[model samples]
Target chain A: MRDNGAMQHSARRDDTAAQPSRMQSAVFLPIGDEGRAELVERRIAEAITGGLIPAGERLPSESALARSLRVAPVTVREALVALRDRGLIVTRRGRNGGSFVADSADPAQFTAKRLGAMSRVALRDLGAHYSAITRACVGLAAARADASEVARIRQRLANADAADEKAWRRAADEAQTEIAALSQSARLTREQMRLQAEFSPFLGLIGQDASAREQQRRAVLAVLDALERGDADAAASAVDAFVRDSVALLIDHQMRLHRA
Target chain B: MKALQATDAPAAVDTVTAFFQRGVDALGEGTRELAADVASARAEGPLTRAKLDAIVLPYAQALFDRAGVTVYGAGFIAAIGLLNDASGHLSWWQGPRHSKLELAAQNIGKEHIDYSELEWYRVPVSTGKPHIAGPHVDYLCSDEYTITVAYPVFVGGEFIGVHGMDVLLDAVEGELLPLLSGETEEITVINAVGRVLVSTNPHRATGDPVRDAGDTLTRYECEGLPLAVLVS
Candidate 1:
């Protein structure tokens, strides 16, 4: 029994390994010898996409950011320029002069473009990849999460509301992240955070629909019920179903957008 | 030293495996792009190192960024480079690669960084599988402590080259050493041959052979690579 459990755990981890190989074209970026600008750009972009840096927030001045990041001022300037070029940030002149994240950066458009470019096979493969990690995570959480962890997840799920697309998406990420964290595996949690940061902007579109929101709620409740009972298999299955349903919705939505 | 706890072994393995797995995933993405380029004849016939750099380096950079991994360098190597140009072996390195100093020092025209024999390249080529080579010094490349994760690239049944990345030894230590949960217990990540990759002990650093021979020690094989961890 113990050996089986170990094997299952390792196999699930391996699933994450396989998914990235298939996701090759979706996330490539150019690296330059002077890496600081690119590094700063990605960090800022992630913060914005992850909602840590809200839309319309003023960024620190070029020199200030450079000092903090320990990069040359030119590097910060280059990063700001790139961000501006992408319309992710805007620079204001005069006393109010500084870079600010654009209001409604519309990250969804970018993510949707990438998703729309992928073949159905790639999309399904990605969906399976996410499902496997999440299933493993929730399974371990169901069997091992402490009272507080379970309660925290339950609280997050209960509080989730789909009235606003941004809030709902944030809640979804928080809920998934909480569940993944319950496994006490940093690797799983890190990957969860990355996936949410990369995909939530696009997934938020699906949450804007009432029926989709209801289905998501049902899935979350089922997983919560399994966790409450310490049923690892049930928790795993619930998460799998939830991810599959979400993936199907997203793919259908993407196909429509592609056709349009 | 303390004996391994069954509970901790899995986490330790998970941490190391995740690091290596992410590298392979990035290479897989790069290989796909390179293969597509080759098929389209976009880069055909006597592909110069500079041409290969322009064509493939962006994907490598993207992988490095998306994964948030720190590495000394990462890029692809064409096998046929040796038969043609002198500097063909080192096809790509991250960023504005092959800085003038490195170019001058490494003697691109005369010297050969013969990768065909390196375990990282050789194992993957032989098995037609991905392999992790060395937590040892890469004198030919970084001249510092590093491990190379390599994947073989094949097009039309022809072995074109290998896509690879080099993770600094200190970075691996920084990433893997803190996974040790106990004060007295030690964790050492090892390759299939039991060469230490990262360890909680400074004396048993990267490239040092694990003395325990992986026997009587709680050894857990890292998924996705023929590597294991000895938590003793």
Candidate 2:
């Protein structure tokens, strides 16, 4: 006897509902102390950039976070305050109130002064590091990922390209993470997320320019195309070029600001 | 008595497999989080092998508890320093139990114990899969009969190293010994290579070669492991 599609459809619906909470636990838990407050704050910030914690989501309460993290309640409070100051979070005072991720109404902006203050050496080193990691990850993804995994990555890349300016920063960050996950190594994915978090505040500066945004999309698409074809060499080269070009542009912009 | 022992084998196999599977999953998750810590540590400046090991130390404890193994070690292919924890459990070579750090320091000077060449670490890095490496002597950690489980740990898509767990063969024997009590006829557990790992018969010891009984002995393979239950 043939059953209706209701059972299968409902099963999928249940999965969709369960996914965010699972992602929340996976992203948030297992946070070891590298200076508890700083690490926790950085992780939460990275989760936001990686799209693990969506905008407008309410954060766990301070005590609850403290209990789960095995940190003093005051430590979570301090980190939350720092996040609020950075405009990454907002706090509500009412009875039904808690900390919430800031709405994606405006992208966080980095000024020319901030860019110029960073030494050329530091900027170059950061870019070189990311280039090394991401290239290796993309190559492995090309060699290992099946068609369906490639499709998921392509979809994320497309979402980033289509996003509005305010949401594009996070969307692009997530696209990089999605590609890393296709490498099928949890370690690679974590490294990608960490590198993205480290550079995202600076990368937001370039997102304001439409031409720059288009260039990024094209660069990612090239990598995507190579991965879909299962060409590891091409995939590595495309990722290398993409990261190299972005670093070059950022350095050029920094030099211009310094000259001005 | 023979019937009771027969019924117990399947249940015991299920319990053991589930235990180790959960351990593998937990260790994998812990090591991924450790990789993130390593990346962040790099953001501050370049990290040396010892510094990297230091960053890994706190996270290594969970691998021991979760895997239900006697000791857990994470060794890099290129690094000189290895991060490991055994919860201060001493091996047969020690006079009194010492800290894992002391044990590691004692073992570090030996030229014979090359982690790079060990099958437990090497096989997983080459194949990028979890592997079982012993039922032989673990010269470095326990100096007793041990079995090792090694899982490849990759960061940035590079095969950086392996995460390994060493379970004392005696400890495994302790866990399996109780089930052997009810059997009347000779019942033995054998490794993949036909060596007796555990036996209900008092005279037959572990690590001894199983004597050929030809058609008299029937062997059943355990699920998800290279082990067999033998009946006569």
Candidate 3:
């Protein structure tokens, strides 16, 4: 019996050690620092993006985690609190108690309603960043993209065409997301996604002008064409020009509306 | 002689099952009542500490009793009082453990556990994926063992948690085996950390890590189970 217990203990230890490998294969980056709350937060975020932490899953309790990590319970609590404020996790009390991850995917209409709640500056800043980042993405895509990726970009443009103003906005957003995804950099993709979420509400507020929409579509197509041609410099320059012009147009429109 | 007799007899799995089933039912009912109380409290405006406890404690106690579960060596609700801020004062509202758990259960029958509170649930500055908390299970049968089940919970068009019950295996082998159907397949529950919370086969109850269970007749298999359905 004692031998059985000892063997079981050793096996369990091996299993625990093996668990990290399983997570690593699934794209979850192991947290490095013991006490740094930021490292914990970043690891959780990466896990979420990597799909290791599925939507609506709960986190471990503070006491349980503290013991496992060899850290103070307070540190765990602090990290959880930070996650909660970001609207990532929700908490409850009573017999069934714990925290859970929140789902970010919502319909276009829902996204629009949320966007309507943003401050003016938030919207403006978001527009600026989207314009800038998207432009960079298109340019990079033009230089480094392959035939299949370029085909995917064209399909996104077609989706944009099929959508209404709101739907088009969503399609455009998806297109930008795909661009980041194609970059194959988990860190860069996360950063861009964060920026996009922050400015989503403002992006929804932008008016749908037929001529402007057509111009944007043409610009995107042209950028894709440059990438397909392998003209990296030209593609980058075109994207830069498009972003500069779009920013100016948006700023001018906003100023005119304010003046009126 | 009585204590020896009790120990000599195997623990009853039926009793353990009944205990857990009763506990889950009680928790579910208590959650509904708590939801109503929270709504009323919110409507009453900023609540004093006394009023909050006055409203919550009774219901919490009732919940623990109904579930046949104890906390801090007493009914589970008593454990609520132990959570204190740096000042040693009861700090319920400062954390969202209760709210998140309640919401998770209500929204999805799953409960979430957090190892780090200060980093995940802090106010103001936020870090990590705001919508993604961390790795957690949607269902928990017990602190040690959990079973995966079909049929997820969806509230307000969202998956929240999972629902299941746990049984103490030693007790089952000792007392409940005689009561169970002869053809009843072996059952066992394991938590995220791979601890055996309960089991039906007496030979499986070694009080060791669950992952160590080899292909012995006493060992149970739980492959292809959803990670969300286990205790984490």
Best by TM-score: 1
Task: Give the alpha carbon lDDT tens digit for every residue of A1-260 in model 2.
Answer: 23437645655666668455665446445556478788778766655554445578777678757754557998889899988988888999999799988896232323455578888888889888888888877877776555654675576556554447646665676567667755644456667656876676566667668888887778778888898897989988887887778878888888878788
- Model 3 chain A worst lDDT window (10 residues): A105-114
Q: What is the interface RMSD of each candidate, in Å?
A: 17.2, 17.5, 16.9
- In candidate 1 the C-alpha lDDT for residue A260 amounts to 97
Candidate 1: tens digits of C-alpha lDDT, residues A1-260: 99778756766776677454534433333444757799889888766654445678777678657754667999989999999998889899998678888997655665666667878787778777777878877776665555544675677667766776666665666676666655544456666555655556556667768788777778877887888787999998887877778788888888798889
- lDDT of candidate 2 over B115-165, digit per residue (tens): 554556666777777766655554445444566666676668865556556
Model 3: runs farther than 4 Å from truth?
A: A1-140, A161-163, B1-232
Give the candidates in order of TM-score, highest first: 1, 2, 3
Docking class of 2: incorrect
Q: Which tens-of-lDDT digit does each residue in A1-260 have in candidate 3?
A: 99768756765676668454654445434545565676566555544443334457766667655544445778768887887887766788777688766676223333344444445576557656766665565554454345555676677568565336645555555555555444333344556656654443334334356666666666667776776775757766766666566656655555655566
In candidate 3, position A30 carries an lDDT of: 50
Worst 10 residues of 2 chain A by lDDT: A105-114
